[model samples]
Target: MSYPAAPRRSAVANAIYGLLNPIPFGFFVAAMIFDIIYAKTGTILWVKAAAWLITLGLLLAIIPRLVNLAQVWITSRRFSTGADHVDFWLNFVAIVAAILNAFVHSRDAYAMMPAGMWLSVLTVLLIAIGHVIIAVRYSTDRGYNHV
Candidate 1:
């Protein structure tokens, strides 16, 4: 007896995903951390750094998102796993949060205040959830079982 093979991304898609997906994650995480530091230190530098990091993350995120969108939704619907779908939505919301945070950061450092910090926190939280969904997609060797 054989288990049905789990729907999987193509090697090229996987490579593209592996390469680009983590970039935004790192950026968002760094931004969040910087936001926290800025909150504590009240330093303009940290806030400026956070803004740049968030902007860069959003820009890099576009490539993989477009590619994944083409593969997962446009090309064909071969994916059976729902995790990617959940992740997509989570990341979408996260990106929006990051965008808003970016605009907030554009204001005077002191003015950005709690709202920018909160937005950064929220963005990182959402992206982390999305990452968890991808991480949990294949915890077992057998992707799925049939009875």
Candidate 2:
């Protein structure tokens, strides 16, 4: 079955995505900072953990939509750019980072919920599977190759 071409990466979208790209990264940083701060102060660990979980959840939810838009951009005939593997890799990396942050944040001295720890591990595994999907699909495309 054929799919519609990906829309061009508009200046607006580019700017937006570019700005948003730091989110996962920032979450990682924030998770670390919060952990260090709270671990030292010995207060509000649960609150920090909650914030980290919220960030992780938001990143997981929004990344798919961004990736879909990127896929459309890559598949579009007008762009003539067939390789979306790089975009997929970036998504994989971002999700992996977020998951790592979640895992790290869940190890707090205050209270580490087993459910959150397991969920982060599952998210990491799922993102790895997504990497496999990108690799398999791109390998079959013949028009794309690993860089």
Candidate 3:
């Protein structure tokens, strides 16, 4: 049996992915920090705004990342190995966590939920780790540099 060749991504696309991929995580961390402050001091505006902004950013980033993942998957035609696998799942979890943080946990400012705050923080950590793994892999992987 034969499989389709992997879709080749342009260097610009790879660079764009590398650059913009972590932005939502930064926003997520900021939002979580704001949420924690709100919990302590009873301020709501910044937390709400941060949460919404991170949500929007996550939604935007997920699309291109998904496309990238599809390209990777088509190239490999099997379960991802090494950093690629880890990056994929970490990103997937982060996206889900971001959604939960924005829609479920972020709905109210009057009551601060520990679960939401922690989830957002966890999402940030996951994204950071995933990015690090990918960056390290990219530095060593010849094919990654070619793109």
Highest-scoring model, lDDT: 1
Q: What does candidate 2's lDDT look like per residue over 36-146, in tens digits?
A: 455457667544664555476556447544645664555443653334545455555646555554555546545644444444445445544555665676577545556
C-alpha lDDT (0 to 100) for residue 113 of candidate 1: 89
Off by over 4 Å in 2: 1-8, 46-73, 76-87, 96-147
State the weakest 10-residue window (summed lDDT) of model 3. 138-147
All candidates: TM-score: 0.89, 0.42, 0.75
C-alpha RMSD of candidate 1: 3.1
Tens digits of per-residue lDDT for model 3, 1-147: 455655456676667776776676677778778777867877667667667777776767775676567646765536355788788888888888787777755567665467667877888888889879988876775443454
Ranking by TM-score: 1, 3, 2
Provide backbone clash counts, one per model: 0, 4, 0
* Alpha carbon lDDT of each predicted model: 0.86, 0.53, 0.72
Off by over 4 Å in 1: 140-147
Query: Candidate 1, 98: how far from true, in Å?
Result: 0.8
Better of 2 and 3 by lDDT: 3
TM-score, model 1 to reference: 0.89
Per-residue lDDT tens digits for candidate 1, residues 1-147, read 777866666788879988998899899889889989999999889999999999999999998888777766766456635886788788889889989999999999999989999998899899898888777776545456667
